[model samples]
Target: MWRQVALEAFPDAGIREPIGASALAEAELRLGRSLPTELKQLLLESNGVIGRTHVDTVWTVDQIVEQNLFFWSDESLARLYMSFDAFLFFGDNGGGDQFAFVQKPERADVFVWEHESDSRRWVANDLRDYLGRSLSAGGDDWYQ
Candidate 1:
């Protein structure tokens, strides 16, 4: 149904194959935390959602693991921005900003991390809202 949700927003939204439970388990192990329930459900329905201009509205599990690990551990990023240990990044604006769930507090709400200023702010109420907002829009910076 998640794929349908995306398609409803943008008929051209690209859908990928659903990820298996084992891959999700490994992803959680690598992140050292469980995936958000809504996000997990979405991924199981469709591994990722490609939005306008081919942006990853929802990333695949592998991308999720790699991006989060990089944001949490990269020394260069650590120096440039606030620590990312509290965020589980899931998508990008195709510019430099990224979208994420609050991991430290484990909230369903989604936030945007504006890359240049290192600012994080509320964007969508939840994963479904995020898909609708991002996919239905016409640009990468649609959240803005």
Candidate 2:
């Protein structure tokens, strides 16, 4: 799903795997926001890249840290970035809702997508579309 999204969003860019748990916990500690359970589960389940890519890529928490892609502290800032990167591409379907937050001290950026919604609206069913669009907008160069 993510791969498809990446292809659509960034046909020229490459998609990678999901980051690891320990890294996620560290990011959470740094950001001071507990990730939503549903989002966590999806990342865990996905294990590797959730989007499309021409080259095989693996997204580990360590890689994110090494690349220095920390979360933003300001909610509004985080919301803006996520809105542009993740949500806008995915659209507000009835599948789930995804959001981004930053770790407190470290300020690492973290993405969370809620699987269930009160209104029964799916936010990220089309993983390919969401990831493709998100990645297309310079996300591939995020780690650089």
Most lDDT-accurate candidate: 1
What is residue 14's positional error in candidate 1, in angstroms? 0.4
lDDT per residue as tens, model 2, 30-138: 5344544534544554433433333223233443333233322346545544322222111111223333332233222344344332112222233333354345545
TM-score of each: 0.97, 0.31
Judge candidate 1 against the unseen true structure and give its global Cα lDDT, from 0 to 1: 0.91
Model 2 lDDT at residue 125 = 33
lDDT of each: 0.91, 0.38
Q: Give the count of colliding residue pairs in each prediction.
A: 0, 34
Tens-digit lDDT track of model 1 for 14-83: 9999988998999999989999988898899889888999888888999999999999999999888889
The candidate scoring highest on TM-score is: 1
TM-score of 2: 0.31
